[model samples]
Target: MTAGSVEVVLRRAGAPDALAAADVWLRSFAAALPTVVSPRSGDDVRQYFRDVVVPFRETWVADAGGGGGIVGVMVLRDDELSRLHELSQLYLDPDWRGRGIGDRFVRLAKERGPEGLDLWTFQVNKPAHRFYERHGFVAVEYTDGSGNEEREPDVRYVWRP
Candidate 1:
């Protein structure tokens, strides 16, 4: 796709597209976290997609060209405790990275007019941290490694308009 030629359309996802979205999730996450163990089968991916990704369809699915399928996704929810918009999951297909799909997804979220937004990332994910920082997010908190011994520390970032 040419620079600025890729057309990304944001819309609510339907049940039929859950599997494709899950595929995107699996691929994206595996690429982002190569050391982390991911689901081994399609069934597991589907189940996780149904339980996690499918339910939060309020503002999801960044479809390239309106028909090229879902290239990116951002699952958002309200943080009742902090009264901020929480970005639960944000992923883009490996092939679509750096094509402005990810940036547009953030732009779409900002356009929704949310008062504030928050998200978490692993400490090693410097690229993501930089991306968020560039988009106006600031690191608010950092948590030591959790239950997972292999997992590293997590950093929480917040953005406010």
Candidate 2:
């Protein structure tokens, strides 16, 4: 490998990583939903994830190999209907994107998750739509923002092996 090469590693999120994961989540969300989400302090976001998401969701964190620190996070929830999984959230540090980390993350999710998976993204997130599609997920439904926090139009995507 070249001296300038970046090594990325993905692993399950641990208790000690919840805070850093939340911080990454906040930074990604702020960048992706700047107009839709209201301003939130890092502490508030930290508390919300520690109190809410960490308790309920299965999570993963991506590390920059060679002690480069966390650069991404993913959260999944089991679907009661079957073995299918629901992707609750996935975010990459804005600075770390476009370098194949997101692709590697998605590929890992597909390997660990069941044959089917569902995910949602705001309609305004064209980049997200493209990203998911590039990984073979297809839009299966659309809603008028009533079911989500942003109250913004959103779409549901599904991936099936």
Residues 1-161, candidate 2: write the lDDT tens digits.
Answer: 11137666778877777898998898898898787764457888788778777766888888775645778999888888756888878999888878777887788778877588888899999999999998999998999989976688899999998
RMSD of each: 2.8, 2.4
Candidate 2 TM-score to native: 0.88
Rate residue 48 of model 2 by lDDT: 73
lDDT of each: 0.77, 0.82
Best by TM-score: 2
Candidate 1, residues 140-159, lDDT tens digits: the string is 89988573344568889999
The C-alpha TM-scores of every prediction are: 0.84, 0.88
lDDT, candidate 1, at 140 = 88
Q: How high is the lDDT of residue 136 in model 1? A: 99
